[model samples]
Target: MKVCFVGSSGGHLMHLYMLKRFWADKERFWVTFDKEDARSLLGEEKMYSCYFPSNRNIKNLIKNTFVAAKVLKNEKPDVIISSGAAVAVPFFYIGKLLGAKLIYIEVFDRIDKSTLTGKLVYPITDKFIVQWEEQKTVYPKAINLGSIF
Candidate 1:
């Protein structure tokens, strides 16, 4: 299956990277920030950069929505996954419309509450995962996958 892994530059990106076992053998690419760390870690991977400072940033959100349309159209990944900040919103929405399965892994840290991105995408996500069992209270339908670390 083809996968599109999308997230922000730091821990969110790291969370997705931890799924290498699942993605390594698949046809996959990434959508993340074009920061130094992402550049270094995904040096040899197919990647697309997205607009950042995405939290509450209308302009970047609009820009990333366009980026999402273009990339998801081009890649046509069968699945899209993220442990996100805010960047994943646009991609998940468009990917769902494009008939790609969406998986949103709630960050390992947020134990009982939801992140903004998680809350925004939960209704549309095909699989919503949480690292802590306690988080199930907030995302009742979420599967408890434990830490991807």
Candidate 2:
């Protein structure tokens, strides 16, 4: 299956990368910041640079929505997965419209509180995985898969 891994750089990107066991055998591409860490980590991989400084930035959010529409439409992945810091929003929303299954893994650091990105995508995600059981209280339908670390 074709997979789209989307997230911001650093920890969010690392979280998705940790799932190599799942995406390793699948045809995959990435959507993330053009930062040094992401550039080094994803070198030689098919990747699309996304708008960044994405935290509560309405401008980049709108820009990324357009980016999401174009990239997701052309790549057309069967599934889109993320452990997010904000960049996942546009991709998940647009991917859902394009009939891709959406998966969101709540970040491992937030145990009791739900992330803004997790809350926003939960209603639409096909699979919502939590790294902590306490997170399930915040995301009642989320499956506690323990930490991805």
Candidate 3:
């Protein structure tokens, strides 16, 4: 199965990167911004770029959306697993429209509630996971996958 890991920098990428071992034998790829931390975490052979800026700017958002749409068209992954900040929004939407499963893993920091993306994509997501049990009250459908750490 082809899998695409989509997320932003720091904690989001770190959590998603941990899943790499499970897909070591399958087709796998990742999408992240041009941040140094994100670039360092990406493997030389299995990564793609999306021009998402850390700050919220209209230009960057539009550029990232276009880049995301193109990547989804080209990769045509079977599923997309995401630990979102913001970039996951476009990736998930496009992947979903293309008939791909969208799996969302809420950020580890979200102890009491779901992240914005988690809430936005909840109904459409094939699977929703939460690391914190406390988040269950907020996202009743979220599966408790424990911590990805």
Tell me the tens digit of each residue's lDDT in model 3 across 35-60. 78977777474788776663456686
User: Compared with the true structure, what per-residue lDDT tens digits does model 2 show for residues 39-113?
Assistant: 999888899999989989999999999999999989999999999978899999999999999999999888888
TM-score, one value per model: 0.98, 0.98, 0.91
Q: In model 1, what are the clashing residue pairs, if there are any?
A: none
Clashing pairs in 2: none
For each of the candidates, give the backbone clash count: 0, 0, 0
Q: Which whole-number lDDT from 0 to 100 does residue 53 have in model 1?
A: 90
Residue 29, candidate 3: Cα error in Å is: 1.3
Query: Under the 3 Å rule for N, CA and C atoms, how many clashes does model 1 have?
Result: 0
lDDT of 1 by residue, 50-80 (tens): 9989998999999999999999999999999
Error of 1 at 64 (Å): 0.1
